[model samples]
Target: MALGPIQFYCNTAVALICGIALWTDCSSRRISNRLILIGLICTGAVVLIEVYFKGDWQNAGGRLAAGGFASFLHGIPYVSGQMGAGDLKLAMVMGLLLGWDAWHAYMGYYGLVLGTAALILCLVPAKHKPWSLPLALF
Candidate 1:
């Protein structure tokens, strides 16, 4: 399907969230809590605006924000978690912005690339410690 205004918004929000998550260590720092909260508010505002001003029911931004929030909440259940709150937040945000037509094909391809890179990193030995260091390399 052709990308519409809503789709563009989704792509942009996801890009922004991903960029922030990649650059900032929201997982380890308390400051990330504020950032995530701000992000949620900003994203939620976009959705509210769209719904009221643009009559948008399919815009993915609001849903993405909620999903990101849910992901954060889910992280609380684990003693030590594998999924990062930022990553989960980003995924939900992307999903919300994607709306009903979330280009699963593209997501699948990207997931494959990420998994391959992760696998390759997992195969490598670490000098400093025994734990996996793929994230450290980046």
Candidate 2:
């Protein structure tokens, strides 16, 4: 799908937020709530603007539903203590921004990346294996 200017800018903002989250996760092994909040707020603003200009409330509603669904699915891992809250929030933001199909593709690619990382980590024994899969994801 071709992205319009606003969508492109929104994606850029998301990328920047992801970079910040990545840095914080790698350095401190934590993704701050503030970072996720920023991402959510920015995405909300963009969606609001789109709805205002395009008069497409249905699209905005769909985005919200997609995000909620993605968040719900990710909540399972969070509840199991296998994923961080920030990671779940990030997935929600991604679904909001990219919609369900894109979010699914992104998650598939993320799983592949995580699997490869895990395989490599297994091959090379380290003194301390990183416990944060979300951090590795970033």
Candidate 3:
């Protein structure tokens, strides 16, 4: 799919959010509520921008529905005690950014990413080292 202006904007923000999420998750095995809140707020702004400028109400609605669906789907893991609520909330924001129409593609792409990560982990030796958080520098 060709990247439109709004899509570019959405992807960029989501990428940044995911980057921070990766860092915190790797170091602490936790996703912060503040990060999720920021992502959600940004997603809300992007939806409003889509509705106002693009005037794509259907797409806007799809974004909302996608978010809800994502939360519902990820809720299973949360209920099973296999995953944290933060994962579900983060998926919700991601769904809002990605929209419902491309959910099939999104899932496939997401699976591919995860598969690649797993493959890399399987092939590479991992060393357990304590995180010397640079956050402590600040």
Candidate 3: tens digits of C-alpha lDDT, residues 95-129: 89878876777678767876875675577655743
- lDDT: which is higher, 1 or 3? 3
Q: Please provide, for model 2 over 6-113, each residue's C-alpha lDDT reduced to its tens digit, 9 standing for 90 to 100.
A: 667766876787788888877787888888788788878878887898887776777788799878878898899888888888878876876543566667877897
* Cα lDDT over the full model 3: 0.76
Ranking by TM-score: 2, 3, 1
Best candidate according to TM-score: 2
Clashing residue pairs, candidate 3?
A: none
Candidate 3, residue 26: the lDDT equals 68
C-alpha local distance difference test of each model: 0.54, 0.75, 0.76
132 in model 1: Cα distance from truth in Å? Answer: 4.6
Model 1: per-residue Cα lDDT over 1-138, one tens digit each: 687675576567666765566556434432255555656666677678778888876554446554655445445632276545454554444445555355464357557877987786678666633353212111
TM-score of each: 0.61, 0.82, 0.78
Give the per-residue Cα lDDT of candidate 2 at 128: 70
Clashing pairs in 1: 60-96, 60-97, 64-92, 64-93, 64-96
Candidate 2 residue pairs in backbone clash:
none
